[model samples]
Target: MTMKGLYNSFMYAARAHAKWEIETSFNIIKNRKQLLILFIMALPLLIPAMAHAADFIGGKSAFGPSFFSPTTFYGSIAVGVVAGLITGCIGAGGGFVITPALMSLGVKGILAVGTDMFHIFAKAIMGTTLHKKMGNVHAGLAIAFLIGSGLGVTGGGMINRALFNYNPVMSDLLISSVYVILLGFLGFFALSEYIGMRKKSPKGGDAHGGPDEMTALGAKLQSINLAPMIKFDEHVVPGGRRISGIFVAICGSVTGFLASILGVGGGFVTFPMFVYGLGISTGTTVGTDILQIIFTAGYGSIAQYAIYGYVFYTLAMGMLLGSLFGIQVGAITTKVVPGTQIKAFYALAILAGFVNRLFALPEKLAQMNYITLVPSTAAIITKIGVWLFFGLVSIFAFWIIGTFIANIPKLRAESGYDVEDTKGGVSQ
Candidate 1:
């Protein structure tokens, strides 16, 4: 009798959790309406930034000439296109390119960071909520996490401002150094993952990092029970247990701080943290992540960067436009290519970014007089790294485009639908 009762109780809890998820989804849609207007209004202002030439007003906003030309406009498009292609093929690592790309174009480091964050915020505003996946979001978890993350975003923003205030060259050096460590780790892991997958047994388990899998950390976080326990995803936990708000906030703080400093949406990091660090189910984590990004990026970009005159609006918009279409095109090509090839490109692409950032660091340090080097030598080395970085990205993007074109017939036949390549409308 006791065993039977326990089974029934578990089933009931699972059902209740599912119902709660469904309710959450409805709320998300209802709230998104107001945000849509803001997205619309932001478009016109961004369009003008591409063509206007001005030095960053007051000189405090950034060191770069505020004036832009066709070079800045078209160049941003090209970078965006490549980034989008990468994103579409691999479903990740899109944010890694923007900061470096902008900086390499002679934009200041602070401006690049601020611009990238703005781009992310703009994109998030336009992102799809039409899928009705909102049910997977846990409001309680999101709210608690936001509390901690809010502080982190503020703290990180201040750190960047302080650094820029101290010395421009020092700021560049610091930002570049951060990128080197991050991209190096990201690229190495990507390479390792790709190589390991090739050697894996056909019947073996997934290559998810140990962090993606539950660990002692997740267990410890979940075990803590303070006042006002927040219950989320009863189905996953069997009994719909509660997590302390404080614990969730701490997790949020970690993600928010990194996102603010790096000028990214933080999805790449947050996904794993929620799943591994906080013991949240992957489904709920994804939904909650989307919710947090909209807030975090918006707050960080506007309050921290834009108000301080650190953002380049035109560049942000150009990247946004280019990446949007690039992602779509890349997504279409994935249907034609083998998955392994895509995986290889993912690793190689990041490594290319790694190389680009690493090579440029010496120049930044040289600028700060932290190292003995000729100015010309530093310039030459940086130029070479920039060339290599963009060269690799463009090659990959073109290869995908060419391959997709070559395989069009096969893809069309497979799908049993022909897309007309007209002069206007959907094709150009």
Candidate 2:
């Protein structure tokens, strides 16, 4: 009789435990669902803030709305989705898209850049998580780059402030002009690179470098006995010793300074540096560069927020959500598409964006011409042309969205969509 009683007690305890477990799980799931809903609700507020600010909203509040329209949220959504799709295909941050989209809306350049940095931080983390799992991201390399870029950020910021404080108007104009020129130059190079690469046969052999070659350039630089040598395990250099301390510092400083001064993430410049200067394989360079950028930009975002208060949380949040989806899609597309063709395509897209920015030569001419009626007509024509171009872009934009939705099934069929199966898989 006593033993029977003990068995009943044991069963009762087991049942109680199972019930508790079920309730806990249900609560956790319920919380997650609520959070997701909140995040979704926040999207509208965030995307516009990132893309164009209130200026994009067609309201009169210091910033005037030219490109940003209250009527065009749907249009921005369409553009954002398409941009996400394209970035996913190319394996890159969609800033190239977001910046232009925001600029089109007449967002102040500084605010657009500050807000974009916030979005990039979130997107980079997402990409890093997935890539790390696939053995693509090098955490050690990331840390090393951070060490260098962290310092660069400070240096760049100081330089920027010094210039602005000394002469705000002249400094601003010079900086913007330089950015336009740089974009123009890079665009040309990208075009050339695209044309040359595209003409190559589709059946070309894989060009990923050998492990020994990964740090050959860095190793050679080590002979100089430069102070502050950082050791990191790079992708191609399998044995945990590649990239000298000095080289990392140099690279970091350059990237940070450029990013801070120009309000850019510096991936375009750093991407090539890793491949050509450091002699890292293309794939390793990209992964490592992103990891490094996350740290650099993460710091920059915080700093910019504190300094300028220029960030529109709404814009940052929206871009983050959009980018989260975009990066995943772009990373996935990298697997099925050939890298060569994608490279050609992305290069062309960047070039196009650069040209759009460079097209402001008339405004410069007007500024020189004393803003007279003759120049006023020129400015008006330019503005109209800008609108017309984006109008045409909207059509292609829809086509891109349709294409992405259409490919969902194919994306699912191909396992591990993050792989850079294509010739030019995404470049952040």
Candidate 3:
């Protein structure tokens, strides 16, 4: 490859990866096997929540917040509805809201992260199913990517715990800062995609890009003939494009690390990585992401966060229930709504998160004496930011639900009048 080739390779990879980061999101549901697993793994975490009312109800602790108040119940439901709407339609930005929303509501930072992961784990069990085609997955690709992701999660979990132990205030600031950056980047691209769509089709059409394909840069990398090569998705690729197993694993590790730290399923990161980096088919990528979320979220929530007493079970359960309804409604709305509007909403959700964290940062810094500021000023600003975020999210959720209601006759007509049984939502 020439110098220009090298630069292009780098830029192309960035572009592809950016697509993955912005486009990946979520879906959810349940099975008996998952319930058994959750029971076994989360038993310890839930026991604490089931504690006597003698325990502090709203009190914050290293363990987590005590639970089951009317306020907590309603609040968790509201949060889940908006989050589900984001995940169902936009395919990103939902999980990003949970931790920040919880923290703003006075849940401890670590607890909020853990609870979100646990909730996702439960949701994945319910929502995810493997490829309808039994042979859909490329075995070599799945194994390599999973190995890499597992390792990444282990490393990320250690880092998160180490930071918390080192300085709780610093931990809060760091997590907040990471969210601010991630949400800002996502929000920017989402708005850009929406704007591009509007400019191209003033009458309103789907503007989001189509299914990802292996680009020329990806093709170049696949031709390297590196050692430990793996041929994947031969059905889609005539020759079954080969890439080094090591390369595949490295991509998985990056995805896993980000997912674990953020307390998400990692689909948002993994989808693009597989499709663009490894050049996997979108169909196969979706299958792989579903499997990966179950493993990643479970391991991170139980082994990494829950073991350290950082999860909130009641909140997770509440969100799970509420998301089922919200995701269903939002998914239906997608059929009637324009992709441009979805992109706009996605941008708003992400930007709201960015603002929430950005405003909360100074308060955390002041707590650590990293900066000097009046407590009242910092608190007021943080309060405003959090409320503003909730306001935007509320607007997004109501709009989606209202749209679904308004379009019920149209949707029902399309579905042979089987609206109740044929919701056909996997609750992504």
RMSD in Å for all candidates: 9.0, 15.9, 6.4
lDDT of 3 at 260: 74
lDDT of each: 0.69, 0.52, 0.70
Tens digits of lDDT, candidate 1, 40-91: 5345435555224322421223443344556866788787877777777665
**Steric clashes per prediction:** 5, 31, 7
Residue 46 lDDT in candidate 1: 53
Q: Which portions of model 3 miss their true places by more than 4 Å?
A: 1-70, 89-93, 131-134, 202-217, 223-226, 335-338, 407-414, 417-428
Q: Which residue pairs overlap in candidate 3's backbone?
A: 24-268, 25-91, 27-428, 28-127, 29-126, 29-127, 30-126
lDDT ranking from best candidate downward: 3, 1, 2
Please state the error at residue 225 of candidate 2 in Å.
1.6
Candidate number achieving the greatest TM-score relative to the actual structure: 1
TM-score of 1: 0.81
Residue-level error in angstroms, candidate 2, position 369? 7.3
Best of the two (1, 2) by TM-score? 1
Off by over 4 Å in 1: 1-67, 200-205, 209-214, 417-428
* Candidate 2: tens digits of C-alpha lDDT, residues 1-428: 13222222222222222222222223323566644754664655656553334333222232211233453344445445545655556544334545555555555444555566665564444333434423555565566677889888887766655554564433344445656665555446546655766786535543222233535454566455555544544433555444566676678788887776665566655654555466555555556654556666778766743245544445555555554454445545565566666666655555555555555445645655535546666667557645654654455344444555677788766644445555356633
